[model samples]
Target chain A: MTDHIHDEHCDHEHEAGINWQLVQGWVQTGILIIMGLYFIDLALPGGQLGNYINVDNFGWLTWVGAAIFLSMGIINAADLLRTRPEEHHHDHSHEHDHEHASAGSLSSWIFLGIATIPLIFGLGVPSKPLSADAISGDLSTNVSTINFGTSQSSIDIPSEQRNILDWIKAFSQSSDLREFEGQAVDVIGFVYKDAQLRGTDDFMVVRFTMSCCVADARPFGLVVDFPTGQEFSQDTWIQVKGHIEIRSIDGIDTPVILADSVEVTSQPEQPYLYF
Target chain B: MEFDLTIFATRFLGIFIEATPFLLLGTLASGLIEAFVNKDDIARMVPHNPVLATIMGGMLGFMFPVCECGVVPVTRRLYKKGLPLSTGIAFLLAAPVMNPVVVASTYAAFGAGPVLYGRYIMTALVAIGVGLIFTVQNRPQRILRPQAIFVPITGGSEAVMPAESERMELLPGIKKALLLAHEEFFEMGRYLIFGSLLAAAMGTLALDKEIETLASNPVNSVFVMQASAFILSVCSTVDAFLALAFANTFTTGSILSFLVFGPMVDIKSTMMFLGVFKRRVVFYLIALPFLLTALLSIAINLNIRL
Candidate 1:
């Protein structure tokens, strides 16, 4: 009895001194609070608040995780199998190295907060993509609302020269696109192969490449009615020039620049079209 | 209060769904790795050749893929199981970038390109570089000890002690598997909840319009945006589209920086790093990626003809 009591005391003294109950309680409470917040987000509508049901992509991963964890738990059980119950159970002194996984230094958080400041203030709060009816959730919604229906012309270019909408938007807004629209504005972008648009010797969908952050990207391309042209593979970036013509593609009003001609630009010094 | 609360709730939930695919994949991959991979076997494979070891460490991730979000917990496990710190660090950095899932997602998002190849190559090199640094400078004893498992009881519900009699009984593999699954689900699930929420808040409340405007500048914009990317706590899979949206506003350098930095360091992942590794280690690890990205972005910009 004395040995048992001493062993218990020694086990207590060795380490992991904090009661598991207390730690578990803290973790559980924190999780519960967070889960509640997620639930609240789910109940609300619109992105202005938050969306909670993001588990779709992650659902499979979670199940896979459960399987993996089960495997580990079993392995651990196997490791513990050989030890005597008394030695394993009652009281075993624990040793703690006393090193902590750093929570991050004060300077780090300050730097982090400083870094995050721009993202907070830089972009307008983004709403979901514009609907067909058009909801001006923000002031920008008003921009699209104006005169979008004014011009609809089909400026056919060879399929080799269509541009991504992201680039087109940028070009439309840029000095290059606005001033040089008719002056043979040459831009480099990638071809997006559309099966439906294939075999038409005019207008290949092109996309400007951005390494990251897709918000400000525009996709505008050359509308080439190539009398005799070769089929350019999809995702190929080519420098092509044509006069700008605003028209409708597949019911949506889009810009169709008539490519006077197309040139296969070698992978330029800059490989991608930055918005 | 009611109006603000309603808007906040709705927005928060929207971001949560956006991040779901990433969060679930990261956690599941992490959980799977922790269960099956034997640490001792991995550690023994590290060779005297630094280059080989690094590549081996990075590539090994395909087989024993893990998540950066759960890096600390898993790293701690590796330490306990006797993995070399250098290899472990390499795996920590490389696994997030080079793993099968992240690679597949990147291919899907960006399409196969020099960019896709660049991400893979660059991450591998960077991870190796950091691992090499650790190898030369620090010893294992200084950083971590063996992994420790704990049990506790409350209100006299049960005695808080290691299982004794049942320790050696090799239960049917199925029985043992079920118990582990239960523990891991609860342990890791809780953290996933916290991490996803934090990521959602960053995406929603913080990344606003004004920030986008600042990112439009060609000169100071890339650094600022890249820095923001590091802190945003977003997953790599979805961030590509978000980065594309910013492409028009910011310089190429900033965009590259954003993509490169975000995958390596973020709010929750940083916390996860700290939770599992020494603070000094996490700090250094985080710093290396940002530094390399800045340089790489500059190079890409200077050489970019378009």
Candidate 2:
């Protein structure tokens, strides 16, 4: 497919003096190199890669992509240096189909522009993880349906050490909410309040768990009951020191955290929890 | 809600980072096929009978193992190397969902139950059904773009041979493959990026919130899921987990439609398809699978339980 371009360029070699084909090749080569460096930067520690994706699942794949891009760029650089314009003319002499050559150059430039859209967004826009505003439909409070490991083993973990996901898993496996009564709870998550919890002294302390990226992000939370729960606005990251109590939420028996304290905290470096 | 640029950028980069490796692998394979594989070999391996050939095409994913993002370039390259028309079409549609990686992921998400089996069975039926439709107008000139067709429509035994000077030894072939891979990468990479941009924009705008309203209606839910699948353009290997998020709220058929149809045709894969097939053929590629999967899923919704 590429041979046609070189063959076409031979026709305009003398008239143009500049090999537009070579310039196009170098542009692509530069784009590949920059793209390679971008992926490598994301894979590094403290990089913003996790803000977008679950790095645990795709961290190594990012490195593989970097290698592929860098290697392809280097190979193209080598090819452009080794092969003279005259050699390309001779190598693809018979493959010239001139009708599409003019159209091909125009379309190739358009494609090159299209290929840079990600780079424009990746560099130009500041990275931010999805927050409560990203919640599209109803918040997932039902713990029974999710397959977040139903071994009844997470309950054994000390209350202070367990995160939102661990608590949800424990809730999923236990037959009764009373089993978690008075369990000391210390977890950090963002506050999410919907219409139902707006008037009451309750709101959801939620964290999104993703098996892949944010496209599949599913929110899981336990209802928090505080006298001033409404004061902690939506999507405010907070550390809740509390104890679990069985309460009837919308007439369904569920575990609700009764908070001793709620302190505002900064978002974690890795915002989304991975299963 | 107003468009959030930050969220759009995050989602765009995430989708691109997750998908690009597969696209690179695809172009690399395309390059290798261009360098090493002979057209005669592809012609020889495919079954002569059209029906068997189409079925074999749907099954080819076990060997190639490309998702929707990677399948287009590989399918185009295979076409260039003299793969039959129906078989190539079938592979293009089925390989994304039929591969082992997707199977394992779907099984992990849904278990060995109706959703898992329904996905594979539905994909095979739709893909092969579309492939068979191509057999009616089996001429390459009718279906493929001019640049995609390499071998003449003559019988396989009379395949055209490359010039002796064009053939290469192992080391040179490897170099040639890399060079071709570089070119193919740029050719196909643009489509992936463009599709990601559209998917990201739609995601940031929260268009899915509008679709969620239609989920309660059984028939509307199937089309709604299909629209979500097309817009989201998530990778097939991990999309099962995404579908799991909707397992409770969505009907069985709609969820199955998302699993089966998402892999075959999405914004990204459709853009890539435009690179290989004629403009009209791309329409059929999208429509054929969409209609077939919808009809079958609705049938399952109305009749079957699981």
Candidate 3:
């Protein structure tokens, strides 16, 4: 009776013993679900996706991607659940080669660790928009040829309207802004002072223009002059209403806004201007 | 050197968020190609004439329109289905930047500039040139890994039963594709994560001091931008924007080289290549693109105004 009981015990172990393959599959699937949720969270209201991308345009793509991840996660989870421990031992590749490396090996665990760390940190951390350090961090503060809708392109708005992007684009393309030199201008951007440009009172009101994401964001701004007594903190978002005046700096004609009033407003609803 | 951990972390997350969705979509497309498409039918459609086959492969992006990350797995699948080595290589090199969406985006970014025409013409030249070189070898057995070997890597493996796969209903077939895609994503995503972190670290270290010096030398600038493209591993769909920042500082030749070469090879894509190709082949894949792009770019610098 003891010998028969031992055989039954062996049978039970074979059927129910932890299948490392299934475990690894579940781990991967679990991460996928986490990632899917992470993206959904980003795509949702008050999420960081808007900070990086134009939510109005690319939000649908994010949802579709999340669905794919979730579906894959579900399918993998189902497969792992249905897989018998014996079948894990009996898959053709394993049966054919006893040397077949199981997914539960030390290296597999290491791989899993590396793969999930980024997602964990990514979701865990607070989102911060790209700032002045990103721009000054580049090679010398030299003129970079402007390309519209690219990561490095300064945020430019080409329309006559008060939008910063179109205004910068128009300003960059035109050698002389004599036509709009005295035009009344209203714009909003963060404070970035280029040390090389004119005096202590001269600072730029800049915004970064992004194409796909923040990885491609480039700072574009127009030079502004505040009255001698007023100084704005670095990276402070402000609304400036002024009139354009032509100033020659570095042998190039630049548009300088003579500010009538500068308000230190809170951050805008949309942090980045998308192409 | 004090590492700006916040900048590193933010850049890391930025690149990760940008590229992951595309990678997932690529894997799903890869799974679809594997589960539903008949190998024999694919083999039949790809022409037997070596040169023509390669040109067709370069243009294959027009139909598939997958990005660099997606194309890696799809090309591996096609190679397994007995697609000619030349054609497969051609398709692999050309598919990322040559497609409609990418071209349209490039046009939108730069307007009607030389960058647009130059990118298309040069990508074709490089893809065709690379494909022709592979035609001489014509041996997937020597080049690709065993898993990548879809045919009898030697001759003993049983041929895939196309008829059985054809009979498989759409729902079951799609389910199979999903499973395959899941497996592939798990396999490939490991490499992508590592590459992304490396890029993030590179971005944070403030390495442009070195890149700035190289920007002036006609020949060295091309090499610098190529190295930057390889290191940054920014997706082709958006690399133009990154390259644009360098436009005034760096030569147009260098920017064009960056635009064309980045989609074909990068640190991240190099990692992905290991999943589908042999070490020797991956080595060649990297070295050949670098050499060809450098030579072509240098020539453009010397002859063309850019």
Every model's DockQ, to 2 decimals? 0.07, 0.44, 0.34
Worst ten in a row by lDDT for model 2 chain A: A90-99
- Candidate 3: Cα lDDT at B1: 34
Error of 1 at B39 (Å): 4.9
lDDT of 2 by residue, B135-173 (tens): 888689888876577654454422333442244678777
lDDT of 3 by residue, A1-275 (tens): 01222121123322234454556777889998998998888888877776655566567778877898999999878776675544433112211122223455677788788778767667666676776666654311322244343324333433235566666656555555676688878888888766555456678888877766665666778778877413787788998888888776676566778888888898887777766
What TM-score is obtained by chain A of candidate 2? 0.87
TM-score of decoy 2: 0.89
Model 3 docking grade: acceptable
Instruction: Put down candidate 3 lDDT per residue, B61-97, tens digits, no spaces.
Output: 9988888778887887777667888898889999999
- Report chain B TM per candidate: 0.73, 0.92, 0.91
Any runs in candidate 3 off by more than 4 Å, and if so which? A1-16, A54-57, A88-101, A137-160, A195-199, A228-231, B111-113, B153-167, B204-217, B241-250, B304-306
TM-score preference between candidates 1 and 3, better one: 3
lDDT of 2 by residue, A127-156 (tens): 778888776655535566555421245878
Worst 10 residues of 3 chain A by lDDT: A1-10
Candidate by candidate, in order, the iRMS in Å equals 12.1, 4.0, 4.2
lDDT (CA) for every model shown? 0.47, 0.80, 0.73
Evaluate model 3: give its TM-score.
0.86
Please identify model 1 stretches exceeding 4 Å from their true place. A1-50, A54-275, B1-40, B144-219, B304-306
